[model samples]
Target: MPTLPLYRDDFYLSTAEAYVSAVHDDGAIELDQTCFYAASGGQPGDTGFLERADGSRIMLGETRHGADKSIILHHPLELFHSDMLKNPTADQSAPVVGEKLVLHVDWPRRYRLMRMHTACHLLSVVCPFPITGAAVGEEESRVDFDMSETIDKDAVTAELMRLVNENHPISVTWITDAELAANPGIVKSKNVRPPMGLGRVSLVCIGENSAVDSQPCGGTHVSETQEVGAIHIAKIEKKGKENRRFRIRFGVPE
Candidate 1:
């Protein structure tokens, strides 16, 4: 496994190509390089297809984080899978190492993830309490924070709308593994932090506010905050002492 493109720059990539390094049965292929973002950092992987030099586009099913944590696995579309089911030897059609292919992501879906992702940041920065954890989805987002005795949905929603209305710019950068190890607060992990010796970690910065909370993240986001339209705090819950959960949704009446 090697460094992937999605981790470096996520502003949106075009005119890139990579050679197929290996393939799994049923349309999962590994490429030498890719722009498809994997399902890490609590953000879903990118969805799209790969086109061969033969003018054939093998549709991508879903992007998943490989156990290796370095390589991204792309599943072929259902139609492609159906063909494989029709012929058990369909695995033979898998792209071979050294075969050049063009990868394309469903821009509409990718855009939605980006918007929702930026919205998650809004949920964190706009609110008063500090975030302890978060999870983002295509339709919704949730974040856990350490707060006072009770959480106020109306106030939080108002703050998020105000922030989104401001339309802040988002950016990402890569920090070396040594720096990340020196400061364990950079990336968020489960009970234990993932090894940072891999050489570089992705840092997502929202708004140019130096006081805003910054963390190591691998998710996709929008260029500006205004794109997250008409969002509100759809739900809230108490998750134990000092932890309050907030579920954010979009397209709701203002």
Candidate 2:
């Protein structure tokens, strides 16, 4: 069954209540609804835990999509241990289908990613080049642009801070699959397209009325640009004749 991904609608939701709809032989738990963000679009999946009625917790190592994108699977941290993963077995205490559980997201880690992911967006705005690739991380993030022009890292950093300090409001709006197909230019990635099989796509817009940017994305983000505080472009590496990878870090470069 397709799980209702609550994080899609509310990025700040760190906790939620849900019923376990399925528990796989390998120990992946599926919930009727979830606030955990699955791994997608260069952003890492969420890591957290599920709590039972008695308050016992099952630590989740990561959240990911199942055979179909609509099915979100929460993998327990214990499942990642070498022996357990090699011969996977469901713990005796594993929740049964229809059991209720309270989902708790590692807010501090998730908040960092949100801040970093938003910083990546601001980088795209400052660079204004076709994004060839990107990755959202807690300590550092990278946005690869398809351009040969040499640009100063410090200049990019300054521009990024300007947008961050401006504290522009960030908002999400939905567009139907057909609408996205009609206006393909709103997508900035040259190689990747937003998940479209789903009826609607999310557009993460920055600034009032999207004065800064409006692009399709399926990742969690901060509500305001200022929340992406103290970010800077640490380096720009030439990967190819026409490609440059810009590394973003949490604080100003030394």
Best by TM-score: 2
Native-vs-model 2 lDDT? 0.91
Clashing pairs in 1: 61-75
- What tens digits encode model 1's per-residue C-alpha lDDT throughout 189-236? 433343354577767776786335466766677767788888888888
TM-score of candidate 1 against the unseen true structure = 0.83
Q: List the residue pairs that clash in candidate 2.
A: none
Q: Local distance difference test, per candidate?
A: 0.71, 0.91
Residue 8 lDDT in candidate 1: 52
Q: Which tens-of-lDDT digit does each residue in 49-115 have in candidate 2?
A: 8887766678898799999889999999752223444656734367899999889999999999999
Report the Cα lDDT for candidate 1. 0.71
> Where is model 1 more than 4 Å wrong at Cα?
1-3, 25-27, 79-92, 128-132, 186-195, 209-211
Residue 111 lDDT, candidate 1, scale 0-100 = 76
